[model samples]
Target: MVKRALISVSDKTGIVDFAKELQGMGVEIISTGGTYKTLNDAGIKVINISDITGFPECLDGRVKTLHPKVHGGLLAMRSNPDHMKQIAELGIEPIDMVIINLYPFKQTILKENVELHDAIENIDIGGPTMLRAAAKNYQDVSVIVDPSDYIKVIEELKSSKDVSLKTKFKLAYKVFEHTCHYDTLIAKYLREKIGEDNFPETMTLTFEKVQDMRYGENPHQKAVFYKEVGANKGCITSAKQLHGKELSYNNINDANGALELLKEFSEPTVVAVKHANPCGVASSDDIYDAYVKAYEADPVSIFGGIIAANREIDIKTAEEINKIFVEIIIAPSFTDEAMAVLSKKKNIRIMQLENIGAPVPEGSYDMKKVAGGLLVQNVNRECVNKEEIKFVTEKRPDEKQIEELLFAMKVVKHTKSNGIVVAKGKQTLGVGPGQTNRIMAAKIAIEYGGERTKGAVLASDAFFPFPDCVEAAAAAGIKAIIQPGGSMNDQASIDECNKHGIAMIFTGMRHFKH
Candidate 1:
């Protein structure tokens, strides 16, 4: 039977009704501080922790419930005869339930210019201890941390004056999980404040589910979307879907890819992504011109792709975008007329990313999961300046071609491995991603470029393993090439470029997105 229940929380939502329901079920309620005052004001009979422990709250409410009497009642095993006898003789009542949620440490640190002392003070020491004690003795005491479970617990008690062992076990697991995450956030923040690297001896990742996705990569597999607990603003996870249908699994993935690539540019740029690879990317002074150029680059591959822009979308741009069947459109902002035009398409998901103008967080991890473990690597934010280029052929690219080559290099960096991008000026003409062989990728990009290949510059994500790709590019009329140039056969490619009278540059850096 749940004869006694302890309640304490920082978020006081719905606690009064919960306490009243517990009281009506013949469960004596014991609370502390704000919770006790709120429950008493609501006319719910309660015993303060000071009364229960026979000690006043000290150290600014930090030492309220850390006494042996409280933890002893929570940790004692009811199944042991000696334990029950000792508690009975010592006038200690068995605590049948413990309700606790830690202080808002995460929220406290979010405030700008918050003092380190204030942040440290918000970290609750006694709450996690009590939670651990009760969870360790879950076989004897029921524990609740989430207020959503209150009604269910009350129903269970009203039915039989007790909750099932299965429920208790589940609640115990949640208690441990919650406390572990709390500690991880506190530890990570402190470490980062001291300018330490993210990788420690032991690492624990924490996330919370945002929603159940429509489906996984395929329609049959079950999938859900989760966001980091302390994720910063300006990413797709924090984007607001202003209109259109619910986001599918593929929509979220492809949209995130588009946003990550879009972060590379601060100009009025439009990026069209298909299957997580950019099919078209263009930048111009006018947003409409940017969208049109990007769309014209590869209208075929962008049939059902996601598109994003760094600038506020205008009506003229929306009119051009509405001509295509896009799955999603995201931008910093959209004009009212632009939204009205785009809203005509009921199935297109439209989102506004408030941080489209903000800078990406430096040195964050791009993590992936595997069968037995996880793979963690720093997010690639590397870029090549004009001084970093190594012009290594008899011929050298002019100022205009060099500018175009750099633009294509940025596009290639965000593409998958064995990727190639062909471009002229500021607009991308073609991109080949995820090809098993370099020759095939070169051919795909050159073919996609068509007549545009005559004076186009090509950017390779990695070094050319053989001279065949350089031969293929020259045969297709590619004017210049930029690559990492780290292969043992670098001389072969340079010889091929010189033999064909083509200009080539080595960046000394590779960008393999996969």
Candidate 2:
């Protein structure tokens, strides 16, 4: 039976009614500070913490419940005679139940320009200590940290006059999980403020559950979505879904790829991604023209793909989008007429991200999970520095072709390796991604581009290993080429480019997306 219950909470959502129910069952309530006043004002009989501990809540209410009387009562085991005898000799009654929630450290830190002292002040010391003690002796004590679990405890107590061991064990598990997440948040915040090393010896990351998906990448796998602790405004997790049933794993993956590529341009741009690879990309003076150019880039491959736009989507863009079966449409904003047209397709996912133009925050990590280890590196922020680009060929590219080459480099930067992109007029005509070899990738892009390859420029994510890629591009009548030029066989490819009068620039940087 729950004879004596201690209640100290930062979140008092249903504490009043819960305390009243416990009091009606003849269970004495012990509270401190605000919780004590809240219960006492509600006309429920309650004992103050100072009365039970014989010590005032000193140190600005920090030393309220960090006493032997509180922890001893909670930790004492009823089944052990020595434990009962020791507590009895000290005149400490057993605490059968504990209700607590920690201070809002996350919310406090999330505030705009919050000070370190204010954030440190909001960290709860006694709350986690009390929760751990009660949870350790869960066989004899019921610990409730979440308000949502109040009805479960109430229902169990009303029927059997006690919380079941199974429920107690589950609640104890939750306490450990909650405390772990809380400690991680505090540690991460302090580490950022203190300017500690980015990658420590022992790294710990915490994320909050967003939702449980129906399946993972495939139907047979189970999966769930979790958002990072402080996800940036530019991230896909920050997008607000206005229409559609729910986002699947593949949908999120492909949409994120499109968004990352779309952030590369400041002008009105549209990016199409299929299976986590860019199928088409384009930039224009207006969003409608960008969408049209992007769609026309690869009309066949873009079917059912994800489209991301940097500007507001209007009715004309929505009408053109409605002509095809698109998996998702993500933009900064959607006009009312655009939404009305897009909403007609009930299966299309519409995501509106307000800060879609924000670049990736500095010092963010790009991580990949491998079989027995993890790979972590800084995110790829730059495609290439314009001043660092070298005109390596005998024939130099014109100013317009240089701009077009830069635009193609941006598209190829996000493509999966081995990657090659054929582009003209600031639009990708063909993108060959994830091929086995460089020449194969080049051949694929040339074949897909066909007649368009006659005057278009080509961009490679990495250096060419041989003259085969240049020979293929020359045969396809490629006007110019851009790639990183660190290969041991770089002279061979450069000689071939010069032999064919094809202008080639060495960016001195490789964007290899494996």
Candidate 3:
């Protein structure tokens, strides 16, 4: 029997009708501040918090619900004789139902140019306290934090004359989850404002679920997509799906790889990714040419892969893309004519990201989950420092070869460890990723490049331990090589490059993406 109900909410959706229903059931309503005014204006019988607390709402209405009467009514166990006697002696009525939602701290902080004081003021203290109190005694109390539960509670009350104990327990669990999410947002915002960058001893991250996928990377595994807190403008998570079926787990994973590699270039570029590794990449004067070059880079491997472009996709690009089978195409924008042509495929996912080239925000962390733990590090934002590059070979690379080497380096940086990228004319001819040995990776890339390996450049994510990789590149007629160059036997690889008259540059930085 919910005789006394407390209703205080920052979101007033469906509150009037809900309070009216409670009033009709002879349940007294206790509210405070804006909620009280809204209910009173609507002509619903309501008692202000001060009326029940016997204390005026001092400290700008902050002290209204902090009184003993409000909590004692909510926390007292009705079935306990001692609890009943204590509340009876103190003249505190048991509050059987509590409906509350916290202040809009997230919305307030999201406002442009919001001040520290404004965000701090929006944090609700009394609301969480009352919710937790009511939820703790859920066996004797029915608490509702979400307005969507109002109709269900009303339906139950109408039939069974009370909220079921199972429903009350679920609602109690929701209160703790809601409060934890709220507090995490506040903590993250404050930490950013105060310039705290170091990882905390204990970290609590909150993400909103975007969708539940039919399955994960494999059909047997369950999976879901979650969006990080705050605005993410350029990433695949922020992209608007324009056509095709819901994104599968594999589609999202491969598309994210293409997007990350695509952002490395400011020029019109197209990146084709398969299984979270770039299969082909190219940059040209226009999107159409970029797509053609990227397709030609590896026509066989790019079939049913993800294509990501930095510029708006035009009709010319779309028509060429439609000739092949691709799982996804994501770009800054797409022309109406291009969309019409792409939509003919029916199943290819088309995504539009207006800010597709936005840089990764500072202090962003890249996290990977492992068994029983998580690996956290800063995002790999650097490809190379051009001025710091060391020409280790006697034959320095020409300006054209230098550009090609740098281009390949950027692609290799995003590839898995023991990775090798072979390129020519700002396009990747072949990529060998996730190999156990450097020599094997070089051989694989060279074999894939085939006839194109002549005059092409090679980029390794890390230094070669021996001269075997350089020897293999020389045999394939590779003109230049770029690597981090921190190996103990670096001289052997440099000597091999010198012997073959191949130009080699040491970037002094390793990018091992395991």
Candidate 4:
């Protein structure tokens, strides 16, 4: 039996050489528009897809490969006698392999000033159809969706004269995954244009498997990393873990928190993260001093926490970090001597992330997982400045208190919902995060603050929502409060603050993280 293959692609990387290699193995090559031209131009004999299907490409080449001849060739089962009889009667040859990639929808949308019509035009139809058809007949046909697979396919054909059954099955799985991800990007883009939040009754999500981790948050559960199947940079999924044990679920979560918090500061900064929340964060004149102060802020919590820095790690910082059993350390770069010192601890993960200080997208969304579903919302990008804040009490905050309030606001924005953070100067006195009730979070913050919160300014990520939080802060001797002021019972909170003679300010912005 003579083998036949179909090739269609928008990205033409290494296609000419691959097709030539297939031709050398006496495999008939069938290809559509641009791919046919490129392969022929490169001195490779190829049959145009129209010739094979006996139909000219119409509707500006969109209807070329949708015909039954192409799909029937791909989907027909080689082992079934009836399917073979039908193929012989129809004069259709079996397509043993398919190589295809979709139109560049992701790249088209990312261009500057891209019109909607251009984006819609980039949505592929026939390519994904052919991929699915070939994938469905994996018992007889092999499919290739990525250009990187060409070398391996060629090598296997050279050795065995045909791809192995295991290789065909794996490639078929990749084909399905590719089309699913392609359709997902198209749907998400079109939905956004129509101003619809709730997509059609049906939901289809696609993520490419990035890695299989050693385990989940604990050692028992299994976990894997999947990245959004599109061009996305500066995301936690794209980060490179240079060295150490495989990351756990909790490690990735804490690393994301540490990176997000580090992005907010322009100066050399260090943040110690524990349980997906910042245990201590500080900025100083030097990166080493910043790490020292942040670590000292809560030495007990910093024992096995993840640390991130905006500057390169030096020998001095490595020496200090080596004293503790930290799980991970991330920085923009590391001195050769510094890495040499830290490399002694084989289990500690070290990452060199370039451009750690670059500004992220201005208006990204935040997603949280619930029991049965996910909640998505626009991120709170509001920053509290002195001019935007309105003090609502007789006793005004001193200059030092005002500075501390600003510092506290930065930390609180990164905390979970119902979060309260107390700070004196640049050091955090106490942080109570990820609670169900505002008062409970406030009580935890105060208890952690202990005697240290006496004159510290308190920052709430959102409004009080009740007067109980104000009472708790006053009882802890907190002198001032800064929060968004939109709750319906705002007066009760104001009344409590006035009675206690505590200064309060409203920035007219809310930061809720659930």
lDDT value, residue 114 of candidate 3? 94
Q: After superposition, how far is residue 430 of candidate 3 from its true place, in Å?
A: 0.4
User: Can you give the TM-score per candidate against the true fold?
Assistant: 0.97, 0.98, 0.98, 0.80
Model 4 clash pairs?
none
The ten-residue window of minimal lDDT in model 1 covers 356-365
Cα error, residue 375 of model 4, in Å, equals 2.6
lDDT of 3: 0.93
Tell me how far the alpha carbon of residue 494 in candidate 2 is from the true structure, in angstroms, after superposition. Answer: 0.7
TM-score of 2: 0.98
* Model 4, global lDDT: 0.84
Candidate closer to the true structure by lDDT (higher is better), 1 or 4: 1
Which digits, one per residue and each the tens of the lDDT, describe model 2 over residues 1-514? 9999999998999999999999989999999999999999999999999999999989998789988999999999999999999999999899999999999999999898899999999999999999999999999999999999999999999999999999999999999999999999998887777664488777777899989999999999999998887747878999999998799999998988888998899999999999999988999999999999999999999999999999999999999999999999999999999999999998899999999988886657788989988888888998899889999999999999999999999999999999999999999988999998999999888888889888899999999989999999999999999999999999999999999999999999999999
Task: Estimate, for each residue in 139-246, the C-alpha lDDT of model 4 and write its tens digit.
Answer: 889899999999998989998888888998999998877887788888877766776445356666667788898888888989997776543555566667778887
Give a tens-digit lDDT track for model 1, residues 60-170. 898999987898899889889999898888878889999999899989887888899989998999999999999999999999998888888888888877998999999
Each model's number of backbone clashes?
0, 0, 0, 0
Q: Can you rank all candidates by TM-score, best first?
A: 3, 2, 1, 4
How much is 51 displaced in model 4, in angstroms?
3.6
Regions of model 3 farther than 4 Å from truth? none
Residues forming the 10-long window of minimal summed lDDT in candidate 4: 358-367
Least accurate 10 contiguous residues by lDDT in model 2 = 194-203
Candidate 3 residue-wise lDDT at 418: 88
